[model samples]
Target: MPRVGLFITCVNDALFPETPKAVVTILERLGYDVDFPAAQTCCGQMHANSGYKKDAAKLARNFEAVFDPYDAIVTPSGSCAAMARDQCPHLTGSTIGRRVYELSEFLLDVAGVEDVGARFPHTVTYHPTCHGTRALGLGDKPIRLLRAVAGIELIDLPAAEQCCGFGGTFALKNSEVSSAMLADKCRHATDTGAEYLAAADNSCLTHIGGGISRLGRTPGAAKAPRPVHYAEILASTA
Candidate 1:
């Protein structure tokens, strides 16, 4: 085996540490020596999206410095990984941009591990982030991985390609539209009666999670709704 570095996004680090931990577990079981590089921060996605290319370049340098030694860099979030794989190339003329690899792409294209040996006995609906779909062009890789789960019932979301509107700053900048988009997503998730609304990006899940919480507290709901990351589910060996 090869050694890989887990580039846990800043938001996941601050608000959802479990996501990265789950990623680490999954990669370890797959036989890669996973390492975490301290001093890493946001991929500067917020800055890049905000049109601050200079700031993004600075963060890209940080990423290159921290991850250059590893054979591969894996991240549970598609958006951040896309930043490295897709967006970073635009910010610089350096070779760092060419070496970036998203987790889904790495697992499917590099490791050749289709069956992750994970098991989950719950109904699930996956929300594919825009970057994951458009930027990384990850079609069904997440679904393929989910289906390998021993007891999982992966339900198809009617408009799985739709955006969750949690485009980092998109939520704060356009709360009304973001709320509407999330409401639609939440309804579809509820329609599936899935115990979990799963996705690669926690940012989208966090947005949908808030709506799910509100819907859960409303009258006559059967139970609380919880959003789960795809990595967390896949990392499960139980």
Candidate 2:
């Protein structure tokens, strides 16, 4: 058995901790030894995306030093994994970069199993995050896995490939534009009448959930679905 290290990105570690916890639950059930390196830090995604190359490189080097020993590195985030796998080596200028697998691809490709014996009884509409769709090109790995889960009704999200407008610092730099984009994303999500809007990335979830929460308070607005990470649903049984 290869020793797997769980890279719980900063956003997940701080705001949405359950996603990583659920990642652990699923991997353990799949018979993998999951280790949390206490020395792990940010993958410099936010810094690099925000145009801080030097700072991002520093973090990338630190990440390499900390996680170099693991045979496989798994993360519940697509953007962060994209950073470590695709961008980190270039940022650090070394062959020291280890392949970082996002949750869905790790399960479908590496683990080679779509059904993790999970059972999620809910109408879930999946939102493919920008990085997961374009950068990582996750394709239907997430959907295929979700479809195999017992008792899960997966709905096709309208304009599913559209961005949720949470591009890390992009939201902070362009607040008004981000809000408008988020409005469209939220409207489409609620239109599905699904109980949950699931995605691999929680940064988008945080943005979408906040938008839905605000919109739900609109006069005569219908009930809105909750934002959930797909890993949480996958970790669910019965």
Q: Cα deviation of 207 in candidate 1 (Å)? A: 0.5
Q: Which candidate leads the pack in TM-score? A: 2
The TM-score, computed over Cα atoms with residue i paired to residue i, of candidate 1 is: 0.95
Cα lDDT tens digits, model 1, 106-130, are 7788888878999888888888889
Cα lDDT tens digits, model 2, 85-115, are: 7888789875644557899988988899999
Candidate 2 stretches greater than 4 Å from native: 96-98
Off by over 4 Å in 1: 222-224
TM-score of 2: 0.97
Reference-based lDDT, each prediction: 0.83, 0.91
Model 1, residue 70: distance off in Å is: 1.8
Candidate 1 minimal-lDDT segment of 10 residues: 92-101
